[model samples]
Structures are given as C-alpha cells and as structure tokens.
Target: MNRNKSLFYFAAFFAMVIYGISTTIIGAILPQLIDKFRLTGYSAGTVASIMPLGITIGSIIFGPIVDRFGYKLLMFVASITVITGLYGLSSTSSVDILRISVLLIGAGNGIINGTANSLVSDISGEKKKSRLSLLHAFYGIGALGLPFMLSVFSSVVSIREVFLIISISLFLLALLLVFITFPVAKKNMGLPLSEILKLINNPLLLLFAFFLFFQSGMEGVAGTWITTLIQKTRIDNYNSALAALFFLILALTIGRFLISFLLKHFTRFRLLQVGLIIVISGAVIIFSINNYYTTITGLVLMGFGFAGGFPIILSFVGDNYQSISGTAFSLIFVIALSGSMIMNIIAGVISDTFGIQYISILIIACVFIMFFLLYNLNSKMSMK
Candidate 1:
C-alpha cells in the first residue's frame, strides 16, 4: 500500500478503537454511575437507552453528509464531539448533563463507526469483508480495554479520572486525523431523494439491512447485558463479571483477526453460515449450563460466531451500492441500530420482569431468527 492509503487505514483502525471504547464505556462505568448519582433502575436504564438513541440519529444523518462532503471534516468534528462528551462525563454532576454527554459520545462514535467501515469498504475493493473484519478487530481491543482498565484501576483511581485520560488519548487521535488524507466524496452531488427511496425499497438492501438488524440486536444485547447476567447467575464479584465480559470481547477480537485470514480460504457465505451455527450452539450452551467456565465458553463461542456478520453483510451492501455506499451504509446502520435499541430495551424489560437468567432464552431466540434471515438472504443472493 502507498503511504496515504496506509495512513488512511491506520486512521480507520484507530477510529474503530475509539468506537469500541465508546461502545463499552457505559457498561463499564454503569455501576459507578448508579452509585454516584443515586439512580433508580428505571433512571439507569434511561441513561443506557439514550446512547443508542444518539447513535441512531447520528447514523441516520451521516450518510448524506459523507457522500456529499468526504470524511475528514466529519471525522474531525465527530472526534471533537466525543472528546467533549468524555470531558463532560468526567466532570458533570447533573443527570441531564450526563445524558447529554452520553448522547454526544454515542452520536460521535456512530458517525465515526459508519464512516470508518464505509471508508475501508471503499478502498478495499474485492477484499472488503476481510478488511472490514480486520478493521473491527481493533474495536474488540477498545471494547476490552475499558473494562479491563476499570477492573484494574477502580480501586486506585476514580472513574472520572479514567474518563479524563481516555479523553486525552482521543484528543490526540483527533489531531492526527487532521493531517491524514482521505478519499474524496463518493457522491459529490449526493443521491437524489427518488434514488434513495428506490435503494431503500430494493429487496436485497432490505434483506441485508434486516439481517444486520438482528445481528446488531444480538450484539448489543450480549455486550450490554452479559456482565449483569454473569454477575447475577454465576458470580457475585463485579471484577469477575468484568473478566467474563473481557473474555467474550477477547474471543470476538481473536475471531475477527482470524476471520480476516480465514476469508482467503472460505467463501464468505459458507463461512457466515457456519458462524451462525456456532452462534446458536453458543446460545444453547449459555442457556443450558450454569457453570462459570461453561458460561465463559459459551460467550467465547458467541463472540466467534458474531465475528463475521457485520463484515460480510456490509461488504455485500458496499459491493451492490458502490456509488451511494455511504447512504447505503447509513440506511443499513439506521435499521441495525434500531434493532439494537429495540432489542436492548426488550432485554431490559426481560431482565426486570423475568429475571436476568432468562436473558439466555432471548439470545437463543434472536440467533435462531438470524439463522432464518441468513438463509433467506443467501437464497436471494444466489438467485441474483
């Protein structure tokens, strides 16, 4: 790769790391926030819910902007938004301010996440799936790092201090992005409304979007609830629960890294089918067994199982909608984030009404639905 492309790739990878950390930061600090703010369960859930809402809004708007304006300005501004969010989160005492901060973080990360994936897909040509998988491995690193940091440093430092440190690192990332060259806008004039409607109505796009719908839902649920489930069912210690969550993300990271290489040997469709099967198997393991090691094992399998879904499906979207990929991605992400938000809300309700252990059943159901969706999606692709 040339120097500019190499730098762009680095920027994309680093952006994903930021996305990863943003994703888990809420979960990592929830308990502390709850205690510090004296929040009720309902109030805490509201705070958790607001972030995805922000992400959804961000995903909805970014496609048109990136397609018309290129990535540098969007990424730079989004990074600054995230940095400000982090600063506010570290310093704020008011719940309203906290909510706003979370919203800023989520919205900023949403833009960065979508932009990074779209950027990588734009440049990766036929290797979009593999490259996207590799790119998301950095997300795993960021996801795992936050909880691990909390687990190790909670006793030594305040969570606020940790947030400040993370903000500093992100500020540096934002600065680096300013000097890097990026791909020009893919659709400088932007897609017409009629064209966007047609793309939205396209059957293949719908399939891919809903497939991601469940995919994002499953992931959001697992990422958000796994720590609580582990704590409630298997362990009483918070650190051990964080450890379980860490193992899950670690497995996901390793699986993505491996998938990047494995795609060279396996067809994307076939590998995705196998990954879905693994997800089902993992969900069953989590549902059937109660042992700590077994739960961890189940989480690992699910991590590996989930590793392929986004990269493969989003690659398909990119390949099919090359001219309006940013818009296409935005549509896909809007649907996907909707699924994430809805399912997370449902999971919260399930936790409140039926108990946390029952969450495994919801996960199992989602995996089965995803399996059905994948079959339909694959059949449709084959027909084409």
Candidate 2:
C-alpha cells in the first residue's frame, strides 16, 4: 500500500509537471513565437487568450468523468493531449494551427490539474488541506523550472527543439502512468438532478467558486503579462522579465510550502486574509511603479499572496462533498477558468488599446473584489 501510494504520488507529481510546462511554455516562448509568426498585438492576445477556453472546457468535463470512471483514464488522455499539443506547437507555422495546439495543451493541463488535486484530496483524508498544498507546490516547482530551462537552453537550442524535447518527455510520463494503479472512482452510477440543483444553488459553493474566479483571473494576468510588462518598461533589459517571472514562480513555490506551517496555527480564513493583504500591496506597487526591480518585487509579493487560497478552498470542497468532490471541483474550476478567460480576453482587448500597464490595475481591482467574496465565505464557513 505504501509503495502504491508513493507511485501514485509520483504520478501526481509528473501530472503537475506536465501542467506546469503547458502553463508557462507559451509565456516562455512568446517573444520567439511573435517573431516567428510575425503576429500583431491583437493576434498575440487572441492566441494567448484561447488557452483558458480549452482549460475551462476540460475542467467542466473532467469532474463527472473522473468521479464515475476514476482518474487513470482522464490523466492518461490528458498527458497524451499535452504531448500532442506540444508536437503541434513545434511543427506548426500557421497561427490557426498554433491556436488549436495550445487549446489542446491547455485542455490537457486543466484536466490533470483538477484530477490531481481531487486525487490528492481523496488520498490524504483529514490532512487534505496541507497535503493538497504540498502537492500543488510541485506545480510551482515545475512552472518555475521551465522558464529557466528555456532560458538556459535557448542559446544552444531552437525554441521548436525545446518544445519537441518536452513532448518526448511527456510521452515517457504518459507511458509511466499506464502501469501505476490509481484510486478507484466513486461508485455512483449517476448524479441526481436534485444533487445537481443543490450544487448549483449552494451559496457557499458559489462564493468559494466566485472567490476562485478572481484568484484564477489574477493568476492568468500575472503569468501572461508579467513578461510583457517588464519588457515594455525595460526595453534594454528584456531578460529581466524572465528573471521577474522566475521570482514570481519561485515565491509561489515557497509560499505553498509555507502554507503547511501556516495551517498549524493560523485559521484558514486568517491566512487567506493575510495573503490578500500581500497580494493587494503587490498589485498597488506594480501599478504605481515603473522600475524593473520594483516590478519583480511586486510580482513576488503577489505570488506569496496568491499561494494559499486555492488549496484551502479546494480542501473545503473536498471535505464537505467528498462523495462528489470531482464534480464539485469541476464546477468551481469552470467558474475560476471563466474568471481567467474573462480577464485575459478583456485584458487582451485592453492591451491593444490602452497598454499592458492596465493589467496590474485590473489585478488590483480583482484583489479588492475578492475581499467581498472572502468575507461572505468566511461568514458562511464560520456559521457552519
């Protein structure tokens, strides 16, 4: 049993690794993509924005399927999707094909993300909160590592080669998933309409989902625009954008690990409030300042702030709705991805008109919006 758990955990780790790569890969290669494709700002934004659309679709679909059929199939299929997507990205020249590739890749990543979190929650029992935090910290590790990998190898290898190598690596990961036995799915043959209605109407669930919407939106903007913001502000020192991106991802990694310790003493709500304060401060600093160093600092601050919310909220979902946790998670994630999509799509349009600078201002507004949701969620959870 212990050995099986270890294998499952490794499977979960690589699952997140795939997601991390997919999540950051576009941002890492964006400049190169633009030069190679000769795309306009609007075209670039369109390409970038479509990824979340695919992710939202995958998130919406994976829940009930994973609940009924188990994680093995979905995870296997997701890995293959990521691999195929990368291959398409590596080989394609047409922006249309590029869009399709990234869409598939994003979908794959989202499925793995939702499935892995739900699986870890299922296995960890009462320790779901801390365990989920630790599991996702691997995601941060993967996300943080990829940009650096690209940075190091770019001089030696073409961007296409980089993605091709990643695709092969994912193939191995998919092959490995075949042999590891996963936890069995919940035995429900069908979801009742009444239960579906209850989930739809659950105020606490809606609040939690609403909170995540902003959470994901903030993350979407941070990941996609941080480099652009840095590049625009520091024309001569373009690499600093990558450096700042590094700091943001690293800070997120450290912050998630910090969450384990935080759970020991801090109530989840207090921790969440603290995270919000830091995120808001970062947003304000980035919006107000122009320096590259300040931008990095602001991003790192927001990183730590964004770290604690998802694990705690997902834990609440898992603990309360253990039987149908997959579907519940799916619902929340769909809402969250919609938030990301709305922000990215709007930010894309805004970027073409005003400037990427507005991205920070929008994130700041999102942080404040989350304040209201958190209060409502806190009130509800406290009563429960």
Top-TM-score candidate index: 2
Top candidate by lDDT? 1
Stretches > 4 Å off in candidate 2 = none
**Candidate 2 residue-wise lDDT, 1-384, digit = tens:** 889888877888777866777788777666667778987667777777778888888898798898888988788898888888888888898888999998999898889899988888888887889988888788899898777876666578776777776778788888888898888878558577688788979998899899999999888878877777777765545466777888998999899999977898999989999999999999889989888888888999999999998888898899888989988999989998888778877777777788878888888889889999998888888899
Q: What lDDT score goes with residue 315 in model 2?
A: 88
The TM-score that candidate 2 achieves is: 0.96
User: What are the runs in model 1 whose C-alpha is more than 4 Å off?
Assistant: 38-43
Q: Global lDDT for candidate 2? A: 0.84
lDDT by residue for model 1 (1-384), tens: 589888989999998998898888777767677778987555666787777777887888789999999999898888889888888888899999999999999899889899998899989887788899889899999998888888887799777777777788788888998898788887778778999899889988998989888888888878877877787789877888888888889988998999899989998888888988888888889889988899999999999998998888888888899988899999999988887778777877787788877777887788778778888988898998
Clashing pairs in 1: none
Candidate 2 lDDT for residue 282: 94
* lDDT values for all models: 0.85, 0.84
